[model samples]
Target: MSAVIEVVSVINAATGTVFDLERDVDVHAESLAGSRETATTTTGRRQLTLGDEVTFRARHFGLRWRMTSRISAYNRPHHFVDEQTRGPFRALRHEHHFEDLGDGRTRMTDRMTIRAPFGPVGAVTTRIVLAPYLKRLLTKRAVHIKRLAEQVG
Candidate 1:
């Protein structure tokens, strides 16, 4: 079974600010510092755009991992999606959405779908273990984005 994890944050910032922060490669590396996550893309830009492909190297759960993902969908100041093209997981997709609250505030949401590879065993493992761990990981990242975005301007 594929597991879906969602986290929502309301931030006192413009949609553009929050959206840019959400897609900044530097911010991502900084936010995942505990995991020592580093991201690099062939395009060599700090901001990710549609069709951009990024490779991530990190250690999680005491295991080193490398994953490559592409910005599959993008709409500036609104929403974007990145899906794992190659990774340990059978499948992974993350959607980042920003909704303008019309008062310099934005509602940002992170929706992630994760699937494991080993059929029944993978399903159960994802449901019982990976899902919760990933949820916490995403939550921490979201909180970091909120804090930094709110501080901007």
Candidate 2:
């Protein structure tokens, strides 16, 4: 298992506003410029729905990566979790959370876990082959999300 990555940003926006917008897949896709796409998942789409699948495709370091993730857990106006069905790593889980500091600002956090193959060998391989790619992806994603959220605020 690889080390999990967590990134956070404080947005000058209401918690409720940010929470509601984040739950709407279409709105999220538009906000993030079509990085995520929603469809009729086998389990269906509902608030806090589990097993509902969604696909996200984006460019990272000029390489296109796609993830078909399932909605595993959620609590409206607070947190949601998604696990990847397809991607580079052997497995991936991502959780999005929000906090209200009572000052009209929302703190958004993203936590991601990835399990790579080959165990120790994979770790070494990743450091050499995938680490840079993943870093660039995370950096680009953070900047994009920050810009999008701030733009809406």
Candidate 3:
């Protein structure tokens, strides 16, 4: 079964700043430093663009996990989407939307669709465990991005 997680936050920064911060590889790594998450890009690029791929390795649930994602869609300073090519989930797609709210503010939304491995068991696990864990993780990341954007915007 597939599950979805959506989180929205208003950032006191311009869309361009928030958008760029979202795609900054270094910022992403810093945001998840508590997890010891590290990322390596296939092209060694600091910023991710359409068609770029990045592999992230982290200690989650007390075990090391690795996931590779590709930037499948990109519309600069507006929105972007990344899909997992290899990860714990059977399938994962994340959409990041940045809406210009004038006066140097932006409304940022993150939508994630994930499918677990096992069939029925995965469904139950997703709802009871995985979903909540991911929601918290994503929320933390968003907060990190917002703080950085506000400081540097």
TM-score of each: 0.98, 0.71, 0.98
lDDT of 2 by residue, 115-134 (tens): 77788988777667565655
Candidate 3 lDDT, tens digit per residue, 1-153?
899999999999989999999998899999999999898899998899999999999998899999999999999999999999999999999999999999999999999999999999999999999999989989999999999999988
**Each prediction's whole-model lDDT (CA):** 0.94, 0.67, 0.94
The global Cα lDDT (0 to 1) of model 3 is 0.94
Best-to-worst lDDT order: 1, 3, 2
Task: Supply candidate 3's per-residue lDDT for 88.
Answer: 93
10 residues in a row with least lDDT, candidate 3: 37-46
Residue 64 C-alpha lDDT in model 3:
96
The candidate, 1 or 2, that scores higher on TM-score is 1
Cα lDDT tens digits for candidate 1, 1-153? 889999999999999999999999999999999999999997999999999999999999899999999999999999999999999999999999999998899999999999999999999999999999988988898899989988893
**In model 1, how large is the Cα lDDT of residue 140?**
91
